[model samples]
Structures are given as structure tokens and as C-alpha cells.
Target: MSPHFPSMAEPGGRTLGDEEVAAAERVIRSGMLSAVWGTEARALEREMAELYGRRHAIACSSGTAALHLAVVAAAPDPGDEIITTPITDFGTVAPILAQNAVPVFADVDPETGNLDPAAVARLIGPRTRAIMAVHLFGAPAPVDELRALADEHGLVLLEDCAQAWLTELPPLPPRPATPLAAVPRPAAPLAAAPPGDAGVRLAGTAGAVGCFSLQQWKHVTCGDGGLVITDDDALARTMRLFSDKGWDRAAGRSHASFGLNYRMTELQAAVARAQLAKLPGVVEARRRTAVRLLEELGGLDGVRLPRPEGHAWWLFPLVLPGGGAREMAAALAGEGIPARAGYLEQPLNRAPVWSGPVYGTSRFPLDGADAGRGPTAACPEAERLVADTLLVIDWNENYTDAHVTAVADAIRKYRPRP
Candidate 1:
């Protein structure tokens, strides 16, 4: 049991305070809570779109909804295959299934825990239609190569940047003839392999479309909101309709294709705008603490930090040897710091629900009523990733240097505990 720390009682109320309250009050006073008109949601969308350098941005109810809209926007045919990494939240894969598309599990780079382009190449087949690269734990994957691969095969490249917000990473590396084969990458999620920089690039800006989460745990929170960014005007228009149940507000109740009601409310939008304003400072605080920790622990024999430029430091992940991450987590917990031994309970491929029938005996994608589940041996490298290392720390923008030092000292005090 951890004792209460002085930092725990800073009176930060969910990143909301007088500022957000004032914004909400203004929205309420306007009497237009819907996003259809020139309201808070619309303004938030405009600001977000411009912020990311995207021509259009669509606000939705959740990050999962944003992904679903992206799938629909791509217009994937039934039974089409989308290659993605398994080391992610269920939201990442659920969209493919919702669109009646098959999710082809691809191996990930052990160091960054990102989709390995070569592994994705191996999985590409006749049914392949798209590839999704998740910036796992806020580190940039090999986006240029993935984009090139998608272009070569006429595939749509979608980026899932849930943990990555404002992550300016390395420039595109030289295109490899083939992506290197995946090996046993220990704590690839925590210890990213540094990609030499040619210049700087943002995480979600690399692909044809990028999805981001603003859930409570993310870099910024609108309580629970999501944003989608894209340069294609027509595609953006289609996404707007998809998010609003196929109704074109500009056309006055005109209907287009079938869609869903995934609109972000004015209240959420109001708070989102406020949060966005504070994001630069939020990011800088985490960056400073993360950098200090790196300097303190980087040379500790078994410790390593992520590539400086590419990592957003969403989680201050550390790769530890042996199987003592659980002990480390417990010890940190005792000191009032949070830690986790592994990223997920299990890789998505091995999840029980994924192996079962969907929509009551319909498994067109995974098992097709025959196997009723996808292949278990898929994404072997992903399996090794979680089993091998520990995420020694979790990050928040409010954490100060003292908090970071406490984390480092705790880890140093205990390691490879038998």
C-alpha cells in the first residue's frame, strides 16, 4: 500500500476548473448543444484541423468511433483484409470487424512495439485492402516505409495514434527493399529502437488518415472524445456524413449512404478546446520529467530510454530483464507511484472473445463459422514483447521532477528481485 504523497493533492480537478466551467457556461447560454450549426463542436473541429495541418478534422464520440468512421471512409469491401499489429487496445481491431473486414495480424518491431513493415509485407495477400500502423505507447513507427508499402500495393494506410499526441519524430528512413524479420524484442514497448533523424515529423500526420484519442487517460481529455484528420477533401466530407448518420446538414436533411451517429457533443467540444490550449504546457511538463529520468537511469546497466525526438512520453516505459516487473510495480505502488508489469493482459490475437463467434455464429472474417476464431500463432513477436519486459512507469503532465526522481530511486532500490 502506497502512502499519500504531497504531489497527489494539488487540487487538479480532471484538467477542468474555472476555465472549462466558463466555457461550458457559454455553450449552455448559446442554447445550441448540437454540432450541426456554428457551435462549439464545429469550432473545435476547425481549430483541431488547423492544429494538425489537416484540411479537415471530424470530432466523434470516442477514439473507437473515429476508427470506425475511418474504416467506413475507406469503403473496404466485405471480407477484405486489413493488416494491423496485435499489441493494442481492442478499439484498434474492432473497427475492421465492424466493417465486415478481416483483420490480418502482423508482427511488430520488437523495439518500438510498432507494426513491422516487413512482417506486414509477409501477410499481404489477395484480400489485403489496407494497413493500420499503431504508434504503440507514443513512439513513431516506420511510417514512410509503411506508406510506401501501402502505395506499392494500393492499400490505404491508417495510423492509430492513441497514445501519441504532438510526437515529433524522426524523418523517413531510406526505404528498405524488405522490412527486417522480427526477433525476440525484449520490452519493445518500453525501449524503442532509435531511428536516425533526417528531419522531424508528427505521429498522426504520416498516413492517409490518422486517428487520435482524447479519453481521460490520454495526453488531453475531453472526458471522452476523438478526432480524425485527413487531407483529402472528399474523404473528409464522407467522414463528416458517416459521423452524423448519413445526414448532410448543409443539404438540409438530405441523406447519403448509411452511417452512424457518432457526433461529439458541444459540452465535450468546449472542454476539448480548453484542454487543447493547455496541451503545449502539458506535453512540456511530461517531456522534462521524462528527460530527467532518462538522464538518471539511462546508464543503469539494464535501463534504456526511447528515441528522444520520436517519443511523446505518454508512458515512461522501461524495459527490465528477468521476470521481476511485477515486483517492481508493487514496490512502486507502495511509494504512491503507478506502474504496470506488461502492456496488456494478453495480445489481442489470444483473447477469448476474438476466438469466438461474432453476431451469434457469424465469423466471416476470423473463422468463418469453420474455425470461429483467427490463427493463434499469428504475431509471435508481439507475444514475446509483453512476456519479456515491463512498463516500469506511467506518465501524467502534472508530475514534477521530484516525482520522477522517486520513481528512479524506487527502481534502483529494487531490480531482478528473486
Candidate 2:
């Protein structure tokens, strides 16, 4: 019989245990569940800030909420644009729409499925307010190049790190010889590489704000929670206020600005703290197994393997450059291995939501000549990836060498024969 593969949806595939249970009990015993009056959430923020070496961290209710907070920090005016990859979760684009900003879908690199800096640079125009980059499937996006591009254009750069925990970014390349003009405002300093992270930058640190998720399927979880890290005091304060209905608690009973109730509850915070302690181990195990699979499949034909360097291996992605990813996925599944083709049904630019009214019967921000106007860009690379080349196997820290071998054997058996 084929060996059973573990999945993130089940307990056996997760890291939760007595520690998380005890954390929940501690919060319940405290008799304070709301973050407004509880210490757990605040403590989580402190720990997150210290971990990422950021000056501040704000805990929120969900990964989407964290991205929304980052959007608020960017302060995009109605109809301004945020350039991002089409290959990411809708959560990445939702915040841009929530703030009445048009999302410009940029093409991705064929291999890495990351936003191509050249594609993003082409999309930037007078109305562009920010650049939100996602480290898709835990592989570091070309943020250093994106950062330089953002700096040259004076755009706010937001990193959606929902899928990347402890994913390290490569060093910044040498600056160009061309003399670029100064930005409208000084850019915030990137977070210093953490101890033992010598010579490499962390994924979320290059941008103005880095957003992380604590959803159940992530490397670590508190059911559903989020954290945002930043060095800019003003941006941190703005996000904190926005997450709490714009109430500046220090200022007596007055609503300070437009905001939402995105605060993380004390219970969630407590559990997340327990999970946080186990993050390094979780990522390390995932890396170890993912690299092993990469090594085993290194010489396979008609397929492209994901580069293992600094990847947190959220999902093991493979590209069938010669096509037939769907059939290969089916064959692997028939053998009891978990795999799927086309991470999304379609890229966001081609999503059905765009063809309909965006805001209660009006396309407001998406209506004008310069507006997004539903599937405007070709994004051919992203389209081809979703329709033909991409395949992802469910991955988790619980995967063993035997599990890796099973997957490798299955792939070797069913890969498209040249």
C-alpha cells in the first residue's frame, strides 16, 4: 500500500500541542479576552517586534486585516494605484480595493511566479501610490530590486509575508551608475538582519511594512491572527489606531480617524505566542525535506524545480515548462500523493469579480480611462503559468524522509515523458 501523506488540515500535520492548550487556558483564567484591556496581545506585539528587529509590531485579527492596516499606512487616495503580482491571494488585492485604490496586476516571472520588477516598473505611473509584493509560496520575491525601483519612484513598498515565515532575502545588489533624484520623503530603514542571520536579509524587512499571517494552514497558527512590523513610528501608530476603530485610547473617548475593529483577541494572541516559539523548528524541518526532494528530482526532464535557497517551502511548487502539469498532478494523486495544478483558477486580473460591480453597483475606482477596467493587462506569463505549467504539492513540517521519497518516486513515474 502507498504511504499516507500528512496534510496541514489535520492535527498530525500540525505543531499544536499542550503548549497551545495551556496558553488558551492562561488567557481564559485572566478573565480579559479583549486586546483593549489584555496583556497577551501587547506581549505578542513586543515579541514579534523583537524577533523581526522592527521598532513596532501590531497584532491584528487576520492576515487580511494586517494587509488592510498596511494599506491604511500607505494612505492611498481614492483612485490611486498599487502594483502587485496577479499570482497571489485575493487578500493582497482586497485591501487596495477597500481603500478605493485601483490594483494594477503585473506579470510574474515564469519560473519563480514572483512579480517581475520590470513588469512592475512598466505599470508605475502618476497615480501609483505603492507597490505591494508577495513572497509567493515562501520564495523571496525580488524585493531588493523592487525596493530600489520603489525608491527611485518614491512609492510606498508593502511586503505581504503571509506565506513566508523566517524566509530570508538575498543582499541588495550594487546601485546603478545612473544618478537618481531623491525621493519625496526619506525611506524608512530596513530591519537589521537578526542574530545568526548573517549576510542575508529577512523577507519582510525590505519594505516599509511587513505583514505576517497566523492562519491554521501556515507554518504556525493561532487559528487566525496577524502581525505587522515596521520601523516608522508614524506608520506604526497609524496602523494601531486603524486596527482599533481609530480610537487613540490615550486621548479621552474620541474617535481619531476612519478605522475598523481588526484587533487580535487575547486568546488568539496567547496561542499565537506558543506557536511563535516553534516557528524556527517548523521552517527548518520544511527546508530540510524540501531540499531533499529538490536534490532527488534535480535531473528530472521536462520539469523545473524550485530553488531551495532561503525558501520556507510553504508548498512545493514545480513548473512543467513543456506543459501537462494537470495530467501529472492527477497521476500523482492517483498514487496517494497530494498535488494540484494551477494554484489559482485564474490570475486575479482574469477573476470574475472584476466583470461585475465592485462597490454596490458601481465600479468607482475601476471605471475611468486610467482605472484598472477589468482584465486590462495581458499578463501572459501569469496566464500561461495558471493554465499550463504550475503544480504544487501540499507541504508541511511533519513530512518525513519516507514521505519525500514517496513523492519523488511518484513524480519520477508520472512526469511527462519527453
Candidate 3:
């Protein structure tokens, strides 16, 4: 009989322990459940900010809220464009629409399913206001190149790190040899970076603001929560205000600007704090097991394994270049290995949302725009990835060496034959 594979949905797969329980009790006993009046959420913010080496971290209701906050910081006018990949959670694109901006779908790298920088460069135009990049399945996006484009075009760059907790990024490339005048100035100079940041470049620190998720399935969980980190004081202040219904606590009961009630509660914050404490161990274990599986499946044909460098291993993805993901997933599932073909039924460019009215029977900003035509034609690589090439296996920190072996055996058996 095969051993049971642990999953993120259950306690066995999660790192939750007595620590999380005690945190909940502490918050309950304090009689303060609201973040606005509680210390727990504020403390969580401080810890997250410090962990990411950012000047500020604002805790919010969900990952979508965090992305929404970043969009708010961009302050897009109606119909302004924000380019992003189609291979990510809708949460990454919803925020653009929520802020009345048009999302321009950019094609992804065929292998990694991350936004292709060259594709993004092609889409940038007069009305382009920002670029939102997702580090898909914890593989680092090429933020250094994306940042360069943002700087050149005076665009805001937002990193969606929901699936990328502790995902390390490559070091910045050496300075270009171009003349100073030829290099465009950034929209705003980044503030002084935090101390001791020269060692590791984590996923969230490369852009203007990095958004993280604390949803139930994330590396850490508080049921549903999020945090956005940034070094810019102005961006930090804007996000803080937006998360709290634009209320300025410093100004006596006065409303400051447009916003929402996206604040994280004390209970959620407390639980997340406990989970955060265990995050390093969680990520390390995941890396260890994922790398082991990579080794086991090293020389396979007709499929490409994800490169382990700086990957958090959210889901172990395989790209069957010859196109048999569906069959391979079915084979793995038959052997009791949890796997799925196509992360989504279809990429976001072809999502059903695009076929319907976005706002109460009105498309508004989408009307008379390239978006109305649907960007499906614009991102062939992303479309093919979702419909044919991609496969993802459920992964978590609790996976053992035996589990990795089981997965490798099944994949080796089912991999397309020449």
C-alpha cells in the first residue's frame, strides 16, 4: 500500500502547533480583536517589515487586499494600463480593475510561466502606469529587468509575492555602461534601504512594493491575511490609509481619501505571528524535499523540471514540452499522487471574467480598449502552457523523503516516452 501524501489543507501538512493555539488565546484574553486598537497586528507588521528588510509593512484582510493596496499606491487614472502575466491568480489582476485601470496581458516565459520582460517591454505605451509581476509558483520573476523598464518609463513596479514566501532572488546585475543622460530617471528615487540587506535578495524587495499572502494555503496562515512592504514612506502612508477606509487616525475622526476596510484583525495577526516564527524551517524543509525530487527526476526526457535556484517550491511544476500534461497528471493521480494539469482551467487572458460585464452590467474602462478584444491572441505562450504543457504537484513543507520518492517514481513512470 502507498503511504498517504500530506497536503496543505490538513494539520499534518501545516506547521501549526501549540504556538498558534497560545497566540489565539492571548488575543482572546486581551479582549481586543480589532487591529486598529490592538498591538498584535501592529507587531506582526513590524516583524514582517523587518523580515523583508522594508521600511514599513501594512497588514491587511487578504492577499487580494494587499495587491489592491499596491494598486492604490500606484494611483492609476481610469483606463491607464498595468501590464502583468496571465499565468497568475486573478488577485494580481483584479486590483488593476478595482482601481479602474486596464490590465494589459503580457506573455510568459514558456518554461517558468513568469512574465517575459521582452513581452512586457513590447506592451508598454503612453498610458502604461505600472507593471505587476507575480513570482509564479515561488520561482523568482526577473524583477531587475522589470525594474529597469519601470525606471525608464516612470512606471510603478509591484511584486505579487503571494506564492513566494521567502523565495530568494538573484543578485542585481552590474551597472550598465550606458551614458548617464541616456539612462532615464526613475519616477521617484527609492528611499534608503534597511541595514544588513546585502546578503539575500528576497522576492518582495525588488519592486516599489511587495505584496504577501497569509491565506490558509500559504506558507504561513492566519486563515486569511496579507502584508505589503515598501521602503518609501509616501507609498507606505498611502497604503496604510487605503487599508483603513482612508481614515487618518492622527486627524480627529476625519476622512482623508478613498479606501476600504481591509485591515487584518488581531486574532489573525496573532496566529500569523506564530506561523511566521516557523516560516524559515518550513521553507527550508520544502527546499530540501523539492531538491531531492529534482535529483530523482534529473535526466527525464520530454519534460522540463523547474530549476531549483531561489525557488520556494509552492507547487512542483513540470513542463511537458511535447504536450502530455493531462495524461501525466492522470497517471500520477491514479497512483495516489496529487497532481493537476493546467494550474487554471484557462489562463487569465482567456478567463470567463473577460467575457462578462466587469461592473454591474457595465464594462466601463474595458470598453473601446484592446482589453475588449480579449488578450488571448496576445499571449500564445501562456495560453499553450495552461491548455497543454503545464502540470503541478501538490507540495508542502511536511513532505518527507519517502513522499518525494513516491512522486519521483510515479513521474518517472508516467513521463512521456519517446
Candidate 4:
């Protein structure tokens, strides 16, 4: 009875169907391959923006580029520090560096793996310009608290919505009665708030801007592309110029500032347009599959499955109880599943790249100016998660119940070799 056979299965490989192929082919035939005001890209942006309750959406080359543009559009001054979670894709951090802004790493909550606002508040300083909250693994961060914190401190709030496109978070609850025995509950929805108004709002609409990824592996695949959604018309226009090499499309001339060519190809846009149409279905499938997996993995000792929420479930992350994420990953790999432990490195702050002159550590005034500051001091919770996390293979609209069961059973049977 080799559990390996059952455990090693994956969701079926994804492919573009007839409609997608037609869209791509149409773009190929049109010869308007580069960025242009076309129906396809426009429609895609409109649809996605509407989907996320955003006023505008600007499609870009990749998620990283979208983040960079969003940071730039938010207009944080050079050398300003942006507080962000360490538990995220480097793309989320790279954009901060690209703007010459320092990324002050704030730790995330161990359970949700999202930026902890309390941790962020502790780390905020004079130069804190913005808070880039990444909704890790499709769970929306506590955006409302982050928003209030941003308002209190006069900081910009930007969302890395690449993981969470259409997810809505429950509101934070109100404080309990201290002296009194109990307080009467508020009306229906209001009563559900978390204690101390700690709940987060949805990423895009709540924050100043939200960014999304349509990378091939994401629930919606546009081959490789990203988008920035903002309610600020002026910022949206500026970002358009930034994406188009500082060219003011209206004037048909180059602007003063040097901007990068972060435009998305029409081909990608066309494909994205079609994909956006299917996002709801794709997201639903991933959610259904994840629900099944969570149920199957329930109550398994030494395995911490992610809690279900109104999340998109990008990656199925499991935290091994006995501190054997690496060994568990290896055991799963030996069984032929595409499982892997968390990042090989510690906090990005500790990475060699950050220590060098390239990251401007010598030039900037971080709290620990001389000592290389790591999340160990600032973000103990995130550090713990980084050490204990493991990932299972996931994709858009590809998973089945059988696949979910297999992954759960694999986790149940995994035993680290001594």
C-alpha cells in the first residue's frame, strides 16, 4: 500500500482553449502588438477594475512592474521608507527598492501570514512613506487597520493585491466592556467586527491602489502581465506615462522624468481579456478544491493547513508542527509531488544583495544603521513562519477532489527521516 501513488498526483496541466487561442491569434493578425488603446486591453482593464471595485486599472508587463508603478504612482519621495511584510514574493519588495525607497520589514501574523498592523505601528518612523501590505496566499490583510494607521501617520496605503484579487475580509470587532459584565451586541454586520477594530477591508478599494498579477501560474493566466488599479485619476495618468517611457500620449511627446517601458503586449492583453472573463469560474474552482483539501487535512497532527476565508487560495501552504518543513518537502518530492520547503534564505534584509552598496544601506538611515537589521528583531512572528512553511503545487481551475485528497493523505503519511 504505497501512499506515494495517491499522494503524488497534481491538478491537470492548464492550457488556453479555443476562445483564448482565437484572441491571441486575433492579436497576432492585427499587427498592433505593442501597447495601444485597443478594445482588448481596454476591455480587460475595465472588467478587472469592475471586478475589484476599482475605478481604473493599468495593465503592465509583470506583477513586479505593476508594484513598481503603483509605488511610483503613489508618489513616495526618494529615500522614504515603506513598511512591508517579509512573508511575500520579492517582487513586492523590489518595487520599493526600484523607487530608491527603503523597505522597512514588518513581520506578519503567524496564523494568517499577513502584515501585522501592530508590528507595522511599532516599526513606523519619521521616513515611513507608505505601507505595502501583501495579501499573502490570497488572504486579504487587515487593510482597514492599515488604512487608519496610514491616516494617523499621514502615510500612503498601497496594496499588493497580486495574491488577493477579489477577496473580502471581515471587519474588525469592537472592544469589550472592561468594568461592566457584558455589553449588548450591535446590529447584525456591525456585531461581527473583531475586537479593537483590527479587521482589514478588501485590498484594492480600501487602499490607495491595488496591484494584481496575471502570470501563467495565477488563477487567471495572461501568459505574463500585471495591472495597477487606482481611484486617483492623476496618479493613473502619471503611471500611464511611466509605463510608456514618460511619453504623454495626449501630447504625443516625452515627459521630463525618465520612465521605464513596462507596457503589456497586446497579445498578452488579449489573452488577459479572455481570461478575465473566466476569472470567477477559475477562482471558484480553486476555492472548491482548496476547501476539499482543508477538510481532508483537518485535525492531522503536525500539519497546519491554512484557515478558510473569503480567499482565493493561490498556494496551499502547510506548516508542519514538528519543525520539519524541509524534510516533509523532501519526503513529498520523493513521492513525486512538487512539494518544497519555504525560502532558502532568512529575511530579505539579511540577504547579501541588501548588504551591498546596491541596496543603498550605506547611504540610508535605517534604525540599525550600522548593524544589518533582520526580521529576527523586528518581525519575530514572520521569522517563525519562514522557518516552518512548506508549499504544495497549485494552479488555476486545474485541481480536482482526487488531487486534493492525495495531497492531504501525503501530509498525513509524511514522516521525516532521522
Candidate 5:
């Protein structure tokens, strides 16, 4: 008998359901299908903003567009430098080049696969304008320390929350003053807030702005959409104009500043709004599924399960013990399991396009070279993960216990020799 189970083969084909279909149809029936500001779009922005505890939210066509708008709103000038991790999708780095700003690659912590705030602090220099930290694989980064580094350097902090929506940072106790400490603590004890409330701050809220993706595989699917959340009113307005092709909301007209047509469609917004209603449930389901899988796969000599988090699970990425990511993915695919590499592609720093003459101009030196020389050094950690991480795609709210067992059984059955 074949060991394959139907549930494990395809996890995310489940669509929005009858109510969502009805909502989308109503929008289509209204004869307003384009990117004009409408009820559906506005409602999604409002609800998403409330979810992240931000003052404003702007929806765009894709996560890449959200990053572009955020970068443009934050930098707004050529030759500015933004420090970002090399382990992310090119979409994160594309916005830096789109604005003609230089991207300084920062290595990630091998354990968390997130940006190292210490590396970011070390990279800060005179031209540093912002630090964009990616919360890789649904785990939150060290937000408090990153914010402190950003504040000390007087630079903007941007969060790539595409993978980590609604994820909260761990509580950090207040540091005690030492003999040479610059500041001392107050004498009176502060009133305790709520229990969970004591340490919780949403991922993007810690930075100057946060961007989220509502793509097909994300926890909340909008087919293809993104949102930018920020407490800065001016930055919010700037993003609105940038996303709407330079239309100034205050003046109610198109402005001279260059912008793009990155607005999300009304239909997408309507579908997303419906999905938003189910987001908390979906996130909880993903978390439970991840826990079950981790338990089943525990004690494996070479494989590493993603650390469980308090929020949504976007992707369940496993690191092979011996570093043969491609080999493991191919082996799993042969067994009718839909496993693949960790990301859509490798890091942007190693892409040939980045090394080409187009981006090698004096304005943007390729690794500080006068000519278009290759990257100064290979991003070994990024390369290792790219070469060795196997990704189980599109974790859904419908995973059963049998499905988890099947996955663990397969991994155990096919133990690769070191």
C-alpha cells in the first residue's frame, strides 16, 4: 500500500469559502474593479492598522510594493544607505535599488535566521539612513535592541514583517545601572501592566514602520497584496501618495513628486477583509500544526525544526543536519510530498543583476568598487541556508494529526547518511 496521504500532498488549495465569494462578487457587481479608494479598501486598511496597533495602514498591490513605498517614504533621496539582511527575498532588496540607494548587506544570526542587531550597529556609518530587519520564518527579531541602535544613530528603523505578522517580541528585563552607568533607575516600583501585556509589542510597531504581505501562501491570503503600518502621520501620507501615483490627499490632487501605481484592487481588498476575519483562527491553527510536527520530529540526529512562536506560522522551514538542502527536497518530492527550498531564490547580493553594469555606476558602487566588481565577500551563511534548508510550503489551518505523522515518518524513513 502506498504510504502517501491526501492531506499531506496539498495543504493550501482551500479557498475563501461562500461568504468570501459573495463579498468579492458584490464588489465586482458594483462596477468598480480598479484601484480607486473605496469602502472595501478603506475598511481593510483600518482593520489591519488596528491589528498592528498602528495609527495608519496603506494597502498596495504586493509586498514588494509595500517595501518600495516604505523605503521611498523613509529615504526619499539618492545615495542613502539602508542596512538589510542578505537572507531575504530580492523584493526586500529591490526597493533599495529602485530608490537608487545603496544596500549594505548584514549577516544573519545562524540560529534564528534573523538579522543580528549587533552587526547592524557595526554597519552604521555617516551615510546610513535606515536599518531594515526581516523577521525570518515567523520568528520575531530582537526589536528592542534594534530600536535602541537606530535611536542612537539617529537612523530610521524599518521592519520587513512579511513573514512575521502579529508576532510579539520576548520580554526584556530592565538593565540595572552599573558603577559607570550613564543613567540610574527610579526609586519607586512601577505599576505592573497585564501579564501577557508586559512584554508584548507587535513586530513592526517597534520600528519606524512595518510592512506585511498578504500573498497567496501567507496566513491571510489576498492572492497578492501588502500593507504598510506606521505611527508617523507624515510618513503615512507620503506612502499614500507614493502608492497612488503622487496624488496628495491633503491637496486632493496629483503632486510633482514621482510615484508609482502600486495600489491594491478593490476585489483583492474585499477578499482580504474577509480573510482578516479568519486570521486569528488561521494563525492559531498553524501554530498548533507546527507544534505537532515538532513533537513528531524531535530527537532527529540531523534535522532541525523551526522554533515554535507565539504568533502565525508562515512557513515550516527545516534545516538538514548535514547541509544537503537540495538533495533532501528532491528526495521528499519523489515521495509525493511538496517540499522545496527555503525561499523562492537565493540572496540578492549574489544575483547576477546586482553585479551587472546597470547598478555598478559611481552613484551605487558595487561593494565600494569604482567599477562593477562582484560582492566583496560571499554571504556564506546566506548561501549555506539557501543551499541546505528544506521548506514545507503553505502551512494551512487544515493540517491533521495523520498528516503530521506522515511527514515525520517520511523524514525518519529517509535518514541521509552524514
Candidate 6:
């Protein structure tokens, strides 16, 4: 028999239930598979909007498409530099290129893996137009600070909450830090509770725009879909129109500008709507398991896990700054635990498209002369974090305390001796 552990909780497997299956079946029976103008797509939008306490949530084909729509709506200028973290999926930066913009990398917090606002502040230049703060691995970046900085610098603050569905930054005067599982939560209607009550707000609600992924591996999945949440009505309309080929539904179906077909199907929307009601449970499960792991593993030599409070625990990322991520991962694998070193092998700036010629040697975005100057070294901390020390294990809504213990045991098994 193979020594590798069985995959525990993939997004689709853990979250997909009777409601999701029934939702899809109902959509199939409805005879209206596509909701180009109405039905489930619209319902999902309203549901997600209300859930996050946002005024608008626009549905789209993919997370990348949602981000692209955000870029198209808030930043349309070519060569505009968007300051973002290097420790993120390409979906975060791909949209910048789609908008003919330059993506500038800012270093990340070694602890949380979220964008370091100070690094972002330093990276801001004359051409810089926006700061895209990714809630990396479900831990929120200092978004309120990023927002204030954006206002101070006249730059847009965009929150990429693709992996951070229910993650929130606690209200000011955060209570004495407690494990996420022990934090007293108001019973029932968690989504309906206003941010003022808990002095806490969801990660995506603070920025000029927020993008979420409902991809297969994300916290929630509609097979493959995306949602754009924003408080600005004009911005929401722009995003909606942009995703719908610039055809403003309110404007008698007239095309307003150049756009793309990034519409989500009604089938996907039906599943997403059903999935929304269960998101609180999804987040709770991951948070509880994550908190337990932190409690057990905290203070372990050569291992660093971010604070459990306010983190969504999308993936249980750990940093071994002493540097044995890959070897540790392999050891964990041998012990019937799953893990991998580095979320992404390198920063976004080092991606081939960044330094490579744009078209026939005309590299307008990276550099007019040499595309090699794409700023890969802009975030050395992120490079080292990924290349030399980061390792992550799957975290999901189905993980239990036992699973947490197993993971912790595997990590300690491979813990490097001082």
C-alpha cells in the first residue's frame, strides 16, 4: 500500500451536500440554464452582498475575471503600477496585465504572509495607482491601515479575499487575544450581524473593491466562479457592465465601452447561493482546527505559525525560518500527512510574462528597453519566505481536532534539532 495519506477535505468534497446537488438538479430542471439577464445569478449577487454587508456583489466567470473587472473599473490607465504582495496566486496579478497595467511587488509580512503595508507604502511611485492587499492564506493584511495609506497617497485599496471568505479584522481595541474557537460568537444569523456589534468586519468590505474566488480549491466553490463586492454603486455598475460585455442592463441593453464576456451561469449561481448559507460552518470548522493546532504547536523551535485570531485558515501555512520546508513536507508525507513547500515557487514579478518581452521585444509594461527589470527582487522577504522556509498543509471545513493533532504530530516529527 502507498504510504501517502488520503486527501482529507477538498473544497468540493467537504462543502457539496444535498442542497448543492438539489440546487444543480433544480437548475437543470428549470429549463433556463443560462441567466444572462436574471434568475439565480442575480439571486447569488444579492445573497453574497447581504452576507458580506456590501451594497453590491457582481458575479463573474472566474476569480481572475472578477479581478480583471475590478481593474477595468477602478484603474483603466495603461502603465499604471498596482502595488500588491508577491506571495499570492497569479489570479491577483493576471488582471493587472489584462488591463495593460504594470504590477509592482511589495514584500509580505513574514508571519502572516499578507502584504506588508510599509513595503507597499515604500513601493508607491508616481505611476502607482492602486494597492491590492491579498488576504494571503486567509489571514487579513492590515487593510484599514492600507486603506488609510491609500487615501493619504491617493491610491486605490483593493482587497483580494479569494482565500478569505469569512476572515475579518477585529474591531478596534481587539479583546485580549483568544483562540479562534474560544472567541464567543453571537448565536445565529452571523452574516446578518452588523460590523459595529462585534467591532469586526469581513476582510473584503473595507477596500475600494474586493474580489473572491469560488474556485474548486477555495473556501467555497460554484464549480468555478467569482464575486466582486464593492460599496461604491458606480463602481459596482461599472464592474457589472464590464463583466457583461459593457452592455448596461439599466441602459436599455446598449454597449457603453469595450468589455468582455465574463458572465457566470445560472447553474453555478444556484450552487453558490445554497453554499452561502453554510459558509459560517465552513469557516468555523477551519478556525477551530487552526486554533487548536496553534495552541499545541506554538513556541515550537524553528516553526512559526501566524496568530490564530482573525485568520480564516484557508491553508495552514507555517514558516520554518531555519529553512527545511521541503524536507519537512516530505517527512510529513511519509507520516500520513499532506504538505508542500512554498505556495508558489517564486514571486509574481519573476513569472515569465513579467520579465519576458510583451510583443516582439516591445516590453511597455516592465520596461521599454529590457523586460528583465520587472522588479522580482522588490520583495526579498517574500522570495525567502517561499523559496527557503514556507510549507503548508490543506485546511478545510471538514478538518477536526484529530486532524489538527495529526498535522502537528507530523510537523514535530520532522522538527529540526537545534
Residue by residue across 1-418, what tens digits does model 6's lDDT show? Answer: 1233324344334678899999999999888888784499999998888877788999999999988988877664887888888888899988887787887787888877788888877777788788888998898789988999999989888889999988888676646878899878788756545533355688998888899999988878887899999989999888887887888777786999788999999899999988888888888878887889999997899898787778888888988878888888888877767688888877676666655676577766657322322356556788787887899887776666677778878777787767
Q: For model 1, how many clashes?
A: 0
Local accuracy of candidate 5 as per-residue lDDT tens digits, 1-418:
1244333224334447876898799899988877574688888999988776678999999999999988987774576678888877778988987897778877667666678887777677777888888888788877778889989988888899888877777666777766767556768886454223455677888887899898876767778999999989989988888897787766767485778899999999999989888877776777887789888878888777777755467667777757776777777777766577657476655766765554545436344522221233355666677767545444667777766776677677765666
Per residue, candidate 4 scores C-alpha lDDT tens digits across 39-67 of: 67777788777666567899899999999
TM-score of each: 0.88, 0.94, 0.94, 0.84, 0.86, 0.90
Cα shift from native, residue 29, model 4 (Å): 1.4
Q: Report model 4's TM-score to 2 decimal places.
A: 0.84
Pairs that collide, model 4: 142-200, 143-200, 172-193, 172-194, 172-199, 173-193, 173-194
The per-residue C-alpha lDDT of model 5 at residue 344 equals 49
Give the better candidate number (1 or 2) by TM-score. Answer: 2
Q: Which residue pairs collide in model 5, if any?
A: none
Whole-structure CA lDDT of model 1? 0.77
Model 1 C-alpha lDDT per residue in residues 1-418, reported as the tens digit of each score: 3333322124452455787889889888999887766478888888887677677888999999989888887778988888888888889989998998887778887666778888888877777888888888877888888988999999999999888887875765676665456545566476333232324467777787899898977888877899999989988988889888899877887898788899998988998999888777777777887888888776776544566666787777776644556666677777777777668877877778765676688766666422322335467677766765656467777776777778878778865544
Model 4: residues >4 Å from true position, as ranges?
1-11, 171-202, 254-257, 359-378, 389-396, 415-418
What's the alpha carbon RMSD for model 5?
Answer: 4.6
Candidate 1, residue 338: the lDDT equals 76
lDDT of 6 at 333: 72
Off by over 4 Å in 3: 174-198, 371-377
Global CA lDDT computed for model 3: 0.91
